[model samples]
Target: MFAVHRSNGLRFLRSGTRTAAFQVRHSSTFAVWNPPKQAPREVPTPLVLCSASHWDSGTRNNIPQIFATMLAEKGHTCIEVDFGLPGDGEMCSSSQDLMDRLSEELKVNLHLSGSPFPPVIFARGFASLIAQAYISSHPAQGLFLISPPPSNTSLFPSILPTPLGEFDYELKFPVAVMACPTEMVQLRKHSRLGQDELVDLIEIDNLEGRDAFLRIEQWLDELGI
Candidate 1:
């Protein structure tokens, strides 16, 4: 049993047995209600925008898919897109053009959801370069790059478009990297890799199964996402 009284732009709630005061602030379109002793529920995980080598289902592998699947299992809404470079005869300009398209898609999705929070971008291999480019203008909660392609390897030589140091990456928000020890070493050659500006480097080989999930969750926790 409770009673609510409204007067002078304020609402007061009084329980029959126990009287408790509540403050309600009214606005043009909504009201802000603050209740006491409300139990916290599970919050929907921050949306994750994932990208890999290509968009086609047939050409795709299971690597980036695994990340999206795992993130979904952890309660995140993961959207996977293909920002990979076209393999000749493709109409798209590949990198920049794909990122612009992705940015537009993200804006549309966020608007439709009506959520003020922005989604984090997750990229694997060469697609990380695209993610880095997108986050420069459009703000995001975070950026996670897994196993970004090495600069000079047995398969490709001088393949990286722009060096990591040259990329216009925003250091305001957190940026995480999950790569092999050798890959991290390779990245250090191009970028001034260190533990600053909310940048974290995790040795992917060190994380396995539940441990990997926990590490990412911990990062989100620290960021208050």
Candidate 2:
């Protein structure tokens, strides 16, 4: 359970005394966390950015925060951004516009971390599209997409339907997709991206807390991160 409160246009959610939280807002609300400043550095530390349409601005309904904290515990700096509510601008934006804005946000976060290697992107639900588009233009160190739609058309009606095969062309870095049994079936059937040489598929009932974090660390270790 998480307690939610708001102050200074930022929301706070406390799962317990140990979960460090900080929130900032732009066109979207971004919650960021890192290991304590005094903590020893993790060589080649990961910069993780998470987003999910199902999440709200606070911990009470925050999938992003859960994922963020989990990654932070693994010695990565994590940031979660909520792009308003689900379906907010899904109706009007062309694929080009979506890619442009997504790339901008990614660049900003990348600069903030200033990591020599590209950051790992973690996205769920509708936010997976944003992760996909960003990876298309800017190769990441890795990508972990949770519960992404099987098709671009299913993801957003405004964009033309495209097979996952085409998206895989842009993914030169390591990638992983985690989805529930039902969504995983459709994703595997429709998206050829999951079959790429650099891609791995993980089936999980839900990606939260310690298990998810351990899996991510294992994946990153294999990638030599």
Candidate 3:
């Protein structure tokens, strides 16, 4: 059993290294993920981290927003982190350096949330790559990768490091991969980690709409997270 919240209060954080924003959303209110941290308070939701494709790109559908809301409604603090990749204006010398910066900021936020260590993180695409890089060395409650990229994509070497070739996340904690029909094959072909035992692969025709949520929710139920 975890801290289950049925409250309507939701808080989202969109943060950068030096700049941070906060927003608290109640029913019928529009909220931005990267709002200034001075919003009116309500019942606090449990805190969890979620990373999505840059700028809500339609390439992966709107699963990012859906995932955030689903967790928020259940009393989890659904923080939507807008992280940047190597060429996405994230001025870092290498992937490891970027991960270190993010890791530091995450630890600080974890302390502020009063949540347990090794948080459950949901990440997608390039964000998923970064998430894996973080979890490889850190302990985590769970890892959910949405539409993950293969380890050996033609473009990966430009952004990722060599040591991540093995990935080996399954040895650290529970891992899951949620992919649409389009991305599922490549995941199995190039990224063997998406295998049944190593990682739970929930294949969907499309990673949008209500059906996608139900499948992902079912997996969470199975994991008891």
Best by TM-score: 2
* Reference-based lDDT, each prediction: 0.51, 0.62, 0.56
> Tens digits of per-residue lDDT for model 3 on 38-143?
4323224232444534423546544555666555444345555545333335576755576666655544445555545456777777667656767777677777
Better of 1 and 2 by lDDT: 2
Best by lDDT: 2
Predicted candidate 1 versus true structure: per-residue lDDT over 1-225, tens digit per residue: 334343334344443222223222220111111222332332344454444434323434445445544555444555544444432454444334545555554444345444466767666665565566667778888887766554323223244332233355558778888776787887766544333435798776643356666777787777776
For model 2, residues 31-91, the per-residue Cα lDDT tens digits are 5565544444544655566564333223233566776665565556666666543234444
lDDT of 3 at 188: 82
Candidate 3's displacement at residue 183, Å, is: 0.9
Worst 10 residues of 2 by lDDT: 157-166
lDDT score for candidate 3 against the true structure: 0.56
**Count of backbone clashes, every candidate in sequence:** 0, 0, 4
List where candidate 2 sits over 4 angstroms from the true fold.
Answer: 1-25, 37-43, 54-61, 85-93, 113-116, 156-168
The weakest ten consecutive residues by lDDT in model 1 span 24-33
Query: Could you tell me which 10 consecutive residues in candidate 3 have the lowest summed lDDT?
Result: 23-32
